[model samples]
Target: MASKTLSNSLVRHLMKRGYAQAAPARSETIQTSVLPNKTFIAGVDTNSPVARVTVAFRAGSRYEPQTELGVSHVLRSAAGLTTGCASSFIIARKLAQIGASVSASGDREFVYYTLEATQDNLQDAVEILASLISRQEFRPWELSDNVPRLKYELAALYPQVRAVDLLHKAAYRRGLGNSLFISPKRIGKISSESLQHFAGANLTAARCAVVVVGDNQDKAALVANCLQLTGLGEESKAEGSKYYGGELRKEMGGDLAHVAIALQGAPASSPASLALAVAAKALGNGPVTKWGADNSVLAKAIGNIGPFAAAGFNVSYSDSGLFGAVLSVPKDEANCAVKAVAGVLKKGGLSADAIRAGKNQLKLQILSEAEAGTSLAESVAAQGLTTGNVLPPATLAAAVEQINESTVNQALASAAQSKISMGAAGNLAFVPYVDEV
Candidate 1:
């Protein structure tokens, strides 16, 4: 009886001091600030054991000049290579010793480098991340060694990705239209000097942001201070992309027809972008649950035609965006499916129940992504870089609450009236062009 009493007392003590493992409180909100040098930083301390920090820059493909088309792809491949202070061997050996990992990813608008580690090791990991982002030294032989990786990534592009790449090309014609992957013709031709020039011109403090998830705001401030890298000049202005409605089609033999038809949508900075996001959900995305066939309106409308896949696709850049749906149908079903999907996009009207369902789904998506550290960091960084302001998931969901039926309807109307652009690949013999759609 005395031993049992002592054990009960010890359990109470541990629980009081937070020694017992438990989920962190969700009441804590996101914190954001900017460094003196103009680098943005944000943090959401869930008081969890794992942590993530990201350094992002407006140094993506859209910023690349006409002379350097594929530098960003090569730049992503160059992560973990030699920096000014540490060799790739040392970076790898030390990070592995600490059991931490880092990654690099990019799109048309920005490039992000993220570091992940246990909460205790995050400070040390930040030091290495600082070196990686600020002290990049693009060596000639090292870049040449990475050509195979570049080729492999490009080779891995299947029909869907190829179609999307062409879709961007048709929509913007340039700038936002730049391909995320290296063009096959430009492979092995991009020079080290080109990369150095692009980095030197674009990765400036004005264009950089640091975002930390799973840690405190003070830690985020420290991380941003550490990344106040100099030497890169002020943000270099890139030519603005104007939407030019056109078609890009690839004639290839295949059983499926992959296509994306779109019109210019609201920019990420605009209030309508969120409603457009909700509309994308309303338009439908295949299946939400496991082992279940899709019940979305798009699926039901086109599913009867043949076995195929259809989903809404919305991409918002800093100043431009694309709103449309993609359809992949058997070549034999392409004629009807393509025209039907395009007609739906151009029609742009949804019922109140559909809008409500879309808002709920989007809210769930936003909150769920916040719980994912990498995605959370990406969201914070992108929001910071593009708008110079960051909204936590909770606040963002609240903003979604402000969106009503009329808001989404107006966004859809605006998009419908915009000129049309289309991209098609894989057995294009049956797919319709923009004019036909």
Candidate 2:
């Protein structure tokens, strides 16, 4: 009866600790590790039919040297070009046969390539992904042919998008100030050699991370281990982004004016960043429900400014961040709306109710985004790039829960006291300069 006695004693110990009735404190499903070749890999089991794998690099537009200003944007469009091991036709055919797809996207701080397929077909998807990431051959002819498409993309950009770009320009002025899209002037000027050189310097295998969701961790690690990226170099560390508060305005002569005002925010992965995020939401994001009236402090302050839209915006990068509000209003209402937004930002007050609402809303947004696998994969990969680790939605939500009211108010107070920068586009006659506002 020795084994029976031992089992009885274990049961008694568990009961004493109150572990049987309640769930364990955590069930860590996300796993991250670095391969021998120095590539970071993160995997999570979603138990879903669709599986996704992402290869993310510190090859964003900001990483471009002064000589290669818009190369990252060009590189984003150069996905699926002929690689060393496969032609365009063969890659497309294989992907179509396997019912999989691959796409590329870039931002200020990262370039992401993602492949999606079912779990059973993930191996095939990995092969296709490898060809794209490890064997890119940016041929001269192919690069030239991409110009028209790039021009079309530039033409299709919305004016508000331009306003956001200008905001970045005025904020940091060089590194983080770079645009996410290629400028029209830079199109066709970026050559194959430039693209290859940029990749060789910034998009190295060691500088990237492969993040897989809805798959076995072991299998995903094996898949990541097989990736042999040709580009090899340590990515240049991001230069410290210093904030310069100033104004950038472009007159598009449209009926609506788009304006963004911001203060220097906290770095990514900092408690201050999370606090600032909660403050952004507290300041007001958007309507709570469809067509619902926003009860946000800013909304209540701007009461009935005709035909206008406004929301707080917060984006955090590895070293620095930006937090503020963006307002779009009719030309007739621009003056009044702009002042009201500026006034609200200047106040930067947070209430108990607002903090509770903001924390709850941010938690819901992150959790919802995680359920949509593509966004979650991108997010995890970005975390993997900067922090060298990833946490699941459950743990992230817990983090939100841990942000007390004091912390949120402290971050807001700090940002509010800092000088603000303003960016405006479309029908600028009514929009005031930063000093005027």
Candidate 3:
């Protein structure tokens, strides 16, 4: 009797607090603007205490010339090094005073500097970003200091990262094929002058953008602060990238065999790109949990091997893309693992239920990334750089829903017939080549 009375009391308390129904959805609006000089500005208002900002450039490794192979990597490392307006120590001290966090990251096609701090300090953060990118001083001593750091970063590239680099090398041969990291062989060859010239030519208002996500009331101030990006630099001369497939192998000795097999894929602008991503998720993304583990199609196909895992990946560039799987296995079973994966792709059949699950997984992945402040800023910046528009997660979710089993099957078939690029590292005696697979 006493227990029943306590339950009744709790129910009455919840009812008085108005906890009886679900809350309504958010507005989910995304706003955009283009400055007179062509710099793009976009904002996504959210209920986050911390504000996020990104100053991005279209000048990635792909734009580097034949003579200066890794100048882009060097330039990226020089992000916080000294600027004409302030010494490195002053920059660091002022940012720390505001309790701001800063970072730099790049890929083959883009580079960016990101800042995250309390909403109240958003304007200060933007000013610091402007100073860093616009007045960056490319001193020779600083360049020498950063080369060792870059080398250390490259030394830590895992098998997956190395495989992707080799895969791009095999697929494009040049331009996009250029490695994203500094090649140890070409370290001393990259002079400070080349770094300055590259930045002067590519970091123009026309090729750069400022992206922010924070309180709705602060949107006007954010845009005003970013206006500092205008009236600077010259246009970039980015060459078109072409896909030419082949094979590349290295005989580095390691316990496990690392192999990556890729074929031509849909570019970022293609509608089929969403379908391809779903198809990849269905293939495999590693076992979901360690204990019971997942028995997805690709997982079962390679189950006979002693120790192995498969991950489906699709890399989309502005003009070309690569879709394939990277497998790590015991060296002796490498051949068997390769054949099994290829056979599954060649003989494609997926169920409707599987397609539904894969689509949901893809949607969740995209949404989760967007909810994270820094990642959403990067996505907006990349979209603005490429197409001058940003796509909301809901639009991508709807696209994933339209994909069915037949769509995935057709995508798989198209991929299987395209020219193949194979890359392998470690004990390579047993690893299969592209033609053999």
Q: Can you tell me which runs of candidate 1 are displaced by over 4 Å?
A: 1-27, 231-235
lDDT of each: 0.76, 0.75, 0.71
Measured on C-alpha atoms, candidate 3 has an lDDT of 0.71
Q: List the residue pairs that clash in candidate 1.
A: none
The lDDT leader among the candidates is 1
Model 1 C-alpha lDDT per residue in residues 314-417, reported as the tens digit of each score: 77777878887776788888888888888888887777887888888777766765667786787678877777776555667787778899999999999999
lDDT of 2: 0.75
Error of 3 at 165 (Å): 0.6
Task: Using lDDT as the measure, name the better of candidate 2 and candidate 3.
Answer: 2
* Residue ranges of candidate 3 with Cα displaced over 4 Å: 1-27, 215-235
Q: What is the C-alpha lDDT profile of model 2 across 1-437, one tens digit per residue?
A: 00111122221221110100111111338778887777788777778798988889889988888777889999989999899989888999999998999999877888999989998888888988888877789999989988998999888876656777788889988889988888889999999998988877877777888888887567667767667664445656565588887879988897888888888787776778878777777776546555566677667767786656667767778777788777777887788778888887777567889889888877766665666677667777788777776666677678778988889878877887777788888998888788876
Please list the residue runs of candidate 2 whose C-alpha ends up more than 4 Å from where it truly belongs after superposition: 1-28, 230-232
lDDT of 3 by residue, 1-437 (tens): 00111122221221110100111112366677876677777777886889888778888888888788888888888888888778888889989999997888887777888888898886787678778887887888887877779888888776656776788889887888888877889886788788878888877777777777774424633544554554454555666677788988877788777777778877777656667777766765665544446466677888755667676666666777777777777889888888887777666556676667677767666766666678777777787776666767776667677877888878777777778887777778898887887
